[model samples]
Target: MALSLSARLPSCSSSVFEKAHKLTTQPPILPFPSNLAACGCTLLPASMGVARRRRQVVGAVEEQHNQTSVLAPKQSPSYSSSKLVLVIGASGGVGQLVVASLLSRNIKTRLLLRDPSKAISLFGLQDENTLEVREGDTRNQNDLDPTIFDGVTHIICCTGTTAFPSKRWDGDNTPERVDWEGIRNLVLALPPTLERLVLVSSIGVTKYNVLPWSIMNLFGVLKFKKMGEDFVRSSVVPFTIIRAGRLTDGPYTSYDLNTLLKATAGKRRAVILSQGDKLVGEVSRLVVAEACIQALDLECTKRKIYEINSVEI
Candidate 1:
């Protein structure tokens, strides 16, 4: 049966980098990065970064021994069932957080990347069954084999290149190709049974030719992204298009934080989700990633499109 993508969507159950999406058969997970469970707590590599924090945690635990047994009181988290998520652009800012949050939630994840080593470097070693890595650029169809989506129930595509001419555009990985052609190719190859495809797009997609948006759309990044969104809408699969504002902060470092992922955005401000594509502002990569995760599990957001930005308190 053909499913029409929703034009307007109600807010999904959400929070400040916290919120859980239910519904799925338990599969696997991609541990959130933070040692404290905010994603990136295990960052900076162990060289000069560990001893200080380790001391803090250990000291705190010891000092609080008369009361809360910090380590002992913490029990292993029981996880709910999850659908398999195929994440593209896994090394990108939002992509990493999504992968990390999925892992933290014990949800199975597969990453399609141009460089698989980046996954290991950014996310560290993970159980192959729970976190699988494949190498393929969205711009290359030959690399996107049918086997890649074999068990993928949900897909989050955050792949994108620079907006203008730069080193990042080398090898024809330009907006026209990466944002438009790449997305078109991916939608064309998606399996029929796919539950949802959440695409990370930009804010000015609708007004690319207008004033401020036109400035950013010099090289047609917004235009191409809109093209991608349109293609997905036209496709048979269910879909959600998350149009994000100018991104502010960076992607959180990922880690094996095996538990229900919450506050994945850390100390970021409140996230504001909007409809009608009227929102214009900056948002953290964390909020974008969190919203994407929420949309995947929200029935109201299915086949819907949304624009999101963050506010500082």
Candidate 2:
């Protein structure tokens, strides 16, 4: 009877089946194999086989459950609905545009700023169901609540001062305070596994310029930005640093798609001239937002930097 039971059990996927097959003993008798002619010793082989298959199916189900539970955390976003993005500095110039772009994509957004009232006024009536505004100061580590960033997959920071102390992008830029400490505090608070990060910084900060006027220019602006960039790059978190040249308040427009992507390859730089470049260009904002999402999706832009400039498409 046991021989009949072993022969009837369907094969399992792994080599464990070979061992099961090698066992010569009359496999342990099933408790309820009743139709086998009243006496266990006289049970029909067919009836015993059916009971064996039932047991096989039960064991298979349990094995599958264990495998799935072990693999759940390792699965990628391609297989899951778990996506959370935290856009810091949502109250600022570029941040507002970023927030709008995120909403347009129908993604739930969490904005962390020093004040929620300013953001509420800027964003107007938001879909209470998706938009969440959490008040937190990035510069103050104690003020940052990890719970606010709990499930965040991407962190986009457009948190630098728009103008230097002298009202220039480079003039009297406080790299130590806003760019250095502020960014350091924020990065320190982030989890090592937080994958995507996009930081909006100014181009031309590769050199030093103590002059009040020059300090607002890229040369001076770069120092502070470099500090922040260094912190982000050194951290375990993957980062994307975007150095934008000469921000203006110009109109929105699109660019040649291929040309835009091509620009990222070489260490090329373009001046965002006042004529066509403005901080409010709809195309630029859209492009930056799209690039950010693509970076997270492709997993190719990890730990890289790129620059954005205005040019004729």
Candidate 3:
């Protein structure tokens, strides 16, 4: 498989500078003294000299701007008003970032969370057309009503739990219940005309029974994740699966949408994208969240499975 490596840089508000051609002028060759002529040099008029100096300064500024543009993040075009994206697990790490980014782009967003009140605390109040929060849990098939997906063009599922049992497993939300059963229920509830479904899964699912992965899968997290992936593959809905490596960066659970929008990968901004289950290492949660959003519109990503990782650059 081909390797897709990308660098994520901080965005700048500076406008792009147009390339400026070098300004050249031939100074009139005037008569000179014998000693001056010996060097074969001609002096430019005082005004021309000043003009050249100004050009040099302008050229330097343009060069700096060009460099900044190369390092700046690409601004994504605003999505169409018709695009209503429903985000499952909207309060989770990657999910929150996805929601914040979609809102920033002015895309209509619908969030399904177990606690509807959390939406107000996280994203604040918004117009009904811009954001709609519904109360539901994927673990309960009854909550996967068709109306929850009405007018939703895209769905991003970021729900998942810890590999080892912990407080997250409270209320019987185990790997089998949340990862496998929850995803299965969600996919089944998707509409036939859905534009796309981006599922966030982990890297070691394919190798869960192997050595170190087996240790992490002792509680069957990886196994259930793979089961969820298979279910989506068999479904009629167009889908993309992003298997992220060990996730780094913040969950930012306490922060509001404004803070989540500003979250960065710090030094770990270079991304490694590949097919198969070959890539190993860590990826920033922000990178994973961005990938899920990007995949929604890229035709080439449809029905594809990608393994992602990141490195400090």
lDDT-based ranking: 3, 1, 2
Residue-wise C-alpha lDDT for candidate 1, range 200-260, written one tens digit per residue: 9988799999999899999889999999989999888799888888876653444423211
For model 3, state the Cα shift of residue 70 in Å.
15
RMSD (Å) of each candidate, 1 decimal = 11.9, 24.0, 16.9
Segments of candidate 1 deviating more than 4 angstroms: 1-76, 252-268
| CA-lDDT, candidates in order | 0.65, 0.49, 0.70
Kindly list the per-residue Cα lDDT of model 2 for residues 44-149, writing each as its tens digit. Answer: 1122344454443343334333221111122122212255778987765456656654554456778897767765566665776557888887767787777878
TM-scores for all predictions: 0.73, 0.58, 0.76
Candidate 3, poorest ten consecutive residues by summed lDDT: 14-23
Residue 296 shift from truth in candidate 3, angstroms: 0.3
* TM-score of candidate 2 versus the correct structure, residues matched by position: 0.58
Q: Which is the better candidate, 1 or 3, if ranked by lDDT?
A: 3
Query: Model 3 over residues 143-234: C-alpha lDDT tens digits?
Result: 98899999999999999999998999999889999999999999888888899999999988999999889999999999999999999999
Name the TM-score of candidate 1: 0.73
Error of 1 at 257 (Å): 8.1
Weakest ten-residue segment in model 2 by summed lDDT: 1-10
